[model samples]
Target: MEAPGGPGAPPMWGPGRKMGFGAALGSRSKGWYTVADGNLSEVFFPFLDHVALHELRFFVSAAGAPPVDDSGDGQHSISWISPGVPAFRVETTHHEYRLTKDFFSDPEENAVLIAATFTPELPDLRLYMQASAHWEPGTDGNFGSVIDTHPPALLLQQQDIWICVVGPFSRANVGYFRSSDVHIDLTDADGHLTYTYDRAGPGNVSAGAEIGIRAGAFQLAIGFAHSRADAEEVARTALQKGAGAVRQAFERAWRAQPEIPPALGKVSGDDGMLARASFAFLHCLEDKSHAGAFIAAPAAPWGETNHDGNHVYHLVWPRDLCRIATALLDAGDSDAALRAFRHLQSQQRTDGGWHQNWTLDGTPHWQSTELDQIALPILLAWRLGVAGCLDHDPYPIMVRPAAQFIIREGPLTTLDRWEDAGGLSPSTLAACIAALIVAAEFAHDAGEHVAANHLRAVADYWNDRVEAWCSLPSGQYIRLGSDPDRRPTEGSTAPEFLELVRYGLRRPKDDRVLRSLQGVDTSLKVSLPAGPSWRRYAGDTYGEQSRLAGTDRRAGPALLFDGTSCGRAGANT
Candidate 1:
């Protein structure tokens, strides 16, 4: 049930796509991103700046044997074709090269160091430099000024930030080379500094400063800052401590993470690897410095092959966050669960419901015109309470208002989880009912009997109408309280039925529950690659057109219910 798709429009591309080693480091402030491959892929502080400078991967060429590809597609071709090692080391029979990149975060700034070890048979280690401000799909973000200062330092500006590439390498062709031309041909240079811009090429236009090493082993420290002073300072420090030390520190942080508790069971073999990777994915998607908000995925690939396609997922949906919270609590990481819950608490709308989605910074993004969003936070808060992760007084200011909104709007025509506005979705009703019952329990725990009774009554009222609200006139269960037709059934509603049972609103043998399961299993239960995944509803447009059909790109053939149905699946007899 491992669904590996996000950030990269294709399963084959994007920083997050091939990530498995969990060796990547992110800034606490989330101002920077550096993968183990030595590419400073993301720098989004003052502005969103992304570039790939690995084109100059310390390749060695004979005196006249032509420098490595100055073409912009070199890195892309390498990433797409060469493949990245899970750990971080590259080798060949003649040239055995070991490269390790690690980034460490500090209150002052985040710095990255790349340590390389290679054989000395080759002459000078040619350096390559191509940088750009934009992604790979459009106009190549041109190269900026390459200012070389005394004591061996070069400041290159791309997009908004100043990148300082400073090291004590024995030699550099462009140890100090400045180019006013936005499009300098790479082949003309001696592998010192080349900022090649190929707008017509299949990959992005970027420029990087390549370093040539006569000695087999050397360290390069790359530092990023909005201003030149900061970049130089950090770059100087990085040049001093080297990449090895940063990698060691980063490894320490990775090890510091509490072990996954045994309660998660014997998560081993293929499933174990998948589970570990999924957990790593969640950690990879989050920004540790800024309130620990999680992005849907890294924002690198959109500007690459996906074009602007990957912008939508870099968000923190409360619904999605709830899934993360559940995982954390189950893993015995109550502290993480609490932080996520508090983050959710921060997003509750003034009206007691929540926005459909939000940025990791807590800014509201796209939302639905439905009740489920409101139901999600309440459900999380209640669960946190059960997990003993709730920090404050039970059922704070947001809880009661949310419960009341469900009481008032639970049965009304609204948006379903899929963002369609019309009828109440069975999932929406079930979520609302769960929220109310839990709210009542929390209120009772707090000795607020009156509030508890009122919430219980609302739960009961909604429990009775849950079927009626989601039923079609044809006597078949509709995807929502109101649906145009019942032909394409919903698999989502099956587990919502179980939520009703868990909330004590229905019996496991309830006829409606059985019928809802039967309806979806009969129609919507198409076999996905992993297993049987239900369409959100019939005629679902998601992954509707296959790439093989030469139509719109489809992200799926994936099941919508990996984490979606776990709790509800518990009610299955």
Candidate 2:
């Protein structure tokens, strides 16, 4: 899809086309706006609407600034700098800047990437941008929801610029610095030479030179500066050698990325939708070695609150990582798939639960609030083994402790009695069972009789529990016994249950597996007046609704199950 704004849109400017002294503004949707000053020296994008499921919007703007002095003179500093935009309200005293719109509609979403930039009229002007994402609370009014509210505040003061991305209970911050001490000099046939120096380190640096040229419909230039020399000399040299080389290198890098054929149109129909969904899921997987696959909406920003301590929609979790990783491996991103497992291994807690949140600093808060710990990691490990990322023997070593934790601790017992301590609910127990089944298969492959027997024993225990629960009506499952407010009617429908049934029944047909799937199929199926067996809800139904609403609300839409069985075509398993 085309970006929300056309070329050269203005900052803080609303939709429509308008001409000004040297500026024009336009927008493709309410979520985005752009502006271009007629001078052609700079452009600004003050609002970026990323489709993050969080309740936040990002506002960013950029402009050119005139060069003053680099002679260490305080006279060059100006406190009243302005980009000539009215929509941005700057509070100097509080050092806070905000947009004039209600960016969050629900308590669980916030606006992110509200930023502004100042460029210079010089060919290589230094770029200065201030960007930030906001955070809010979740819709559920539990204390655990509060943990998802505020954006993590990193302790770093100023040695490095803060790069903050909001996750479930915190923000991920990476510090970057530009390397100094690198200098270059270029000369042409005319004896004109331009000398440039590198100013590394995070804060802000100026690119003082721009090679005057264009390549492939883009303005091309070498971004550099004179080495404390005459401006005219540097400009002449940059125009001749530096600019050309930089432009070529950048073009090559841009073209190096994997390409999508132009024939790939908007994906429609079932097959196309599945392909597109799988592609998107793969694209979101972080290529970093230790990082788990993150399900971040492309370009989505963090959410913010309205100073009332009310929460909005900026959140993330490692559990989602496990889910997305399973999808990624299914989609053929084996490296990323393995990375997710490795991340789980690195972040597992001593209590046998995985940390729900993976912050930038690697600190696991171990919020004993929810109980996906034993379940998600174990399942991921099993999938990794099947995918050949783990060996059979190692599989049992990793799976046994987690399973033992669940059984010995009474999977249904709460870790935090006040707020549903990280313990097994039906959904979690089902996930644990599924992982053990996978482990058992791996053990059988490795000829480890002891491991296989132990796994079978554990699986039997889970099977008995599921069988007892199945004795209930079609929809009921065992709830965590320790939850005081637990109701027979309250239930969760994560793909976890479907995964358990599918994995458990992979061998010779088990009646229990068939019964469970039948129950799930019955409860999840929906029929329209026109047809039956043609539709069903996937695991992401709620997540998709949350994305559309721009908030974290559970009462959005119901999933439907048509003819497609849970494991065969539907997404849960």
Candidate 3:
């Protein structure tokens, strides 16, 4: 019988959202894996943009009881195996049993290894491994098969790309997702994978295996390659090397970099928060095929029910890249920051403005152009140039055109930093004014004094006129728009107003800036028990909302799993 969704249809957003990820050093690894709700989730291969495996989760059940997925039915927790590396140790607990998995990427191959241990050694306990494969960026139109090898493996393929799941299995089977998968049947009736199939179609497909946990432990590896044989070989070799050896190499590789300062090693309430942030940031740069092309996040935001399209956040934003470069500079990773600058140079459009976002290979994914993206790179060049990180000047090729692009088509942005609403924006203007001023410094270094003078002149003009262009009659900055008098009837406040002070166009203690902050806090602040947090804006609609009374989607009064806009509410940071 076909499943309720459809026969071999695409999978839903998540077993759960990504909690953390594990990737080896950028120089040695091409594979990255994420831990979500304590389950191995979203294995990316070759490139961070391509998701080869949707999930590889462990299930355990007594002989006649239904299986409990590590993701959904267990209490989950995760932590890095080391402070400096992205490798993770995830633990999930239940009344019946407990599972602990140490996840690490194989440094020498495109593969990930997990060493797992189950607790209490129950005699009737059976451990099953199930892998849902996507095989490409979007999770659709994939094929799966069971390979009868010595140790046995499951292979998923999409055109030329292949991914193999290698491990010790007493028996293996392949099946269509949800409808006829052995994993589902195991959960539905008995705790055994009895309804085994040999192959699944060119739709949502997965593979299942009954793994024998000897003394409460087992090992598995997920590997990727252009050919099926090579993929299996890579995984087999990784598993043969053992997770202990592979994990040591992974941690040692990351620790080879400069040590993080003791102050940054831990935070007061959230120990390891800063260190984990650094590791997560560096994880995005681990793509060997595209050095320094870091995606914003290795996640699929709002992915719970929205799985049909390729709207994941695993793409590069030049604005985010520039900020990351600045942070890298602060963290003493000059090499990574410089590499990012070079990658930005490669992605710069002929018109000099970058697309709103792009894939790691310099392919434009979204066609919109944000002025902040055009300006931020020039700012980065100036920072890098000032720090002597740039061996050669960037004026002629990068900074010059980028500065000119801003002058030609901006301080008025086609899209704001949020990729919403056009026209005058406080933050966009701040970026343009700052970028032109820095670009002027590069222009002078390049012996183009006239260009330098003109750039500074434009920056000064924007700096002086920003208040007139953005402030409402009451002195608060409007979230967006060209005219100050045309403020929206509903109150509006954005964190974007702080950019004027951040970019040095305004003083922190200035009366106007303080008034704007007051307005923002009064309008957007949510006083939670933990602390005060601000919403994106007064009328932001980015998070969960109630379903409308009659329509499939719209603003309404009842909260629903569907993220369709129901009403404006605080989706805080």
Top lDDT hit? 3
Writing each residue's lDDT as its tens digit, candidate 3 over 1-573 gives 222323364454442257877677755568888877677778877788877788887777666777776666788788767665787888888887888988888888888888998784576887888887763434446778888777678888866778898887888877777677755778677776776576776777778888855447888988889998898899899999999898888778777877655566555356656665575556455357888888887776655445644667788889878888888876777888898899999998888878888898888889887898899998888888777899887889999999989999976787887775787888889989999999999889889999999999999988887777777667778667665445443335776878888888899998888898898888777787777777777666665554432331111122334534522334321
TM-score for each model: 0.67, 0.44, 0.90
Off by over 4 Å in 2: 1-159, 162-281, 285-302, 306-316, 369-372, 391-393, 413-424, 441-448, 470-500, 504-573
Cα lDDT for residue 468, model 3? 72
Backbone clashes for every candidate come to 18, 59, 3
- Candidate-wise lDDT, in order: 0.50, 0.33, 0.75
Please tell me which model should have the higher lDDT, number 1 or number 2: 1
Q: Which prediction has the highest TM-score against the true structure?
A: 3
lDDT of 1 by residue, 1-573 (tens): 111111112111233332222224444433434342233344344212223232223333334444442221122211211111122332322232233332333323444455555454444444433333333334333233334444355444544556666665432222111121112323345333333221111123233444445455666665667777887788787666656555555555555666665544365544354454456556655555545465545443322233443344557777677778777677676776777777777777777777777766666767565677677778878777777777686476878888877777656536666564556566667778788888898789888999999888877877776666666443355665453233233323333445566656677776766776788677566675666765555544433122232222111111232122322111121
Q: How accurate locally is residue 81 in candidate 1, as Cα lDDT from 0 to 100?
A: 11
Off by over 4 Å in 1: 1-40, 43-109, 115-129, 134-143, 149-160, 166-205, 211-220, 265-289, 300-310, 394-396, 412-414, 420-422, 446-448, 471-478, 483-537, 543-573
True lDDT of residue 52, candidate 2 = 13
Query: What's the distance in Å from true for residue 466, model 3?
Result: 1.5
User: Candidate 2's residue-wise lDDT over 1-573, tens digit each?
Assistant: 111111110111111111111111112111211111111111111112111111111111122322121111111111111122111111211012211211000001111111222222333322111111111122111000011124321111111111122221112221111111001111111211122222212222112122122111111111111121222222224333432343333234323433332234344343343354344434423422225534322221111112222111112355666777776676566666676676666666665655545442345433443444566677787677667876334454556566556556544535421132343444555565666666667678778778778877877776566534422344433223234333243343322344445455332255544554565566555565654441122332221212332231111121222222232223332
